[model samples]
Target: MYINTVSHYLPSEVIGNEYFTNINNLSHEWIVERTGISERRKASAEENTSTMAIKAVESLLESIPYSKNEIDLIIGATYTPYDTIVTLAHAVQHQLQIPDIPVVSISSACSSLLNAIEIVEGYFALGKASKALVVVSDHNTAYYNEMDTVSGHLWGDGASALLISKERQTDSDMHIKKIITGGAATSGKAIEAVVLRPNDRGVIMPFGRDVFQNACVYMPKVSQQVLHACGLSIDDLDYLIPHQANHRISLNVINTLGIPVEKLISNIQYLGNTGCAGCAIALSENKEKFKKGENIVITVFGGGYSYGAMLITI
Candidate 1:
């Protein structure tokens, strides 16, 4: 599989760390020292997961040379949904008006993006589709409690869209080398570490220490697994994009893998944790910087004890 084009949408409203200090009584210095996030974007009242997803798709369509009718599959991934029934996938399909293709919506917390891509890979392997559209969006603020000091400041709203093809269609296409994903819900404090329950005070992290420990372990472990699956090494990677959940997690993964800190790509500092859209948004942000023959790896870990990694070559 090859990535033809990618795009992202970030809201205009910016929430600085001081905003949290006022609402949650968490000092700016303390928040920065812990998460390294200075500010995060907040979606407007009219904006939601599906709307941001549509904007991202519109941006993608503006750049692609082909018609929208060529897209055969549509998949939406998000844990924070505006409506569980209609789904982000249905909203995107309704906006794009692409008829009669397999449309599905899935959630596995932050790993949903890679899981959705893996589904596209399955479709390609079965010869059921050659071109597909994957949209990932998370309206974290919509379901987060700004007053609860635990995880209220860790979220922001954003979305990303990826256009993938079974065959390379352009000179700039990035090759998908390997993808690996798994669930650790049975192990470690995976189930209760981080959670988002409806009418249960939005998002909360009662066991942040456990979530941190698990992320530090799995993000690097999965990164190495996917790299080895492609017969590549950390030395071959031009860049490593870990889940944008925390700066410390990204640092830990790179240090564990012997990857240089300069090779790390992250946006949590400015955009906060955009849930499953984080890695995809980073890829879209840095799409033009990758050189030919360079390799990039995106590893992720989400709240539901879900983790995944993908190796891509430019």
Candidate 2:
């Protein structure tokens, strides 16, 4: 499977550390070091999970000329959706004027997207569908405990959409070379960055330090596993796109693996923690940075202590 196209939508309102200084007890220096985020785009009042996804679909459609009938599947991967069961994918289909296509809504916290990745990969492997869509959206800004300080500075809101299809032919220019995914079972009590209250409950709360520690271990190990499965090591990849968890987790993973910083493509400095959108956004932005036929490893890690990686050759 290959990602045919990708589009990202970030709100116009950007919040810096100074906003948190007045709202909560925090500093830019600390946020920049710990989370690797200098600024983040917060969704405007008009934007929600579904609307954000719609914007991405609009952008994606502009690149690929396709009607809804061509889309056999629409998968929404998000921890924060419009509703518990309803998702952004359905809204996108509606906004795009397509009906009757099967839409699957899935959640794996920060790891929600890789789960969707697996789903798309499998659909192609089984020859079940030709063209598919994976959309992710997070209105996490609304969930943050501005008064609680735990998740205020770390969370941001954004959306990303991707179009993927089965390799029409070997020479078709879109093919998925390999994918390796895994998860680690950390102490359940140690997890954070979860919805304390359901979609209708309390609010979004994240245990920053706890999430960081698990990521340090979870990210590198899975990346190595993905590399090993493909019979290639980290040294072979031209770029590494790890989950945009935080500044500390991303650097620590690279450091632990002994990978050069130049071999990685990171946008956390601009977009903040976009959760599942990180991989799609990073891959899209770094397309020009890679040499043709160069290999790239994209890693996705999330709050449930879930971690996974994908290795692909462009």
For model 1, residues 195-275, the per-residue Cα lDDT tens digits are 999978788899998999999999999998998998888888889999999898888888999988899999999999999
TM-score of each: 0.99, 0.91
**For model 1, what is the error of residue 173's alpha carbon versus the real structure, in angstroms, after optimal superposition?**
0.4
Residue 227 shift from truth in candidate 1, angstroms = 0.9
- Candidate 1 global CA lDDT score: 0.93
Where does candidate 2 have its weakest 10-residue lDDT segment?
167-176
Clashing pairs in 2: 35-247, 193-206, 197-202
- Give one digit per residue, the lDDT tens place, for model 2 in 1-314: 77777778888998888888777768888778677889888898878888888888787888774565688888898776766655677787777776776688787777787788788877877887778889988888766666656666777788888887775433323345766665565545345455545645444554566667777877788788877887888778677888886767777888999988887688788888887887787776766666667887777767556777777777
Q: Give the range of the ten consecutive residues with the poorest summed lDDT in model 1.
A: 20-29
Error of 2 at 204 (Å): 5.2
Let me know the TM-score candidate 2 reaches against the reference structure: 0.91
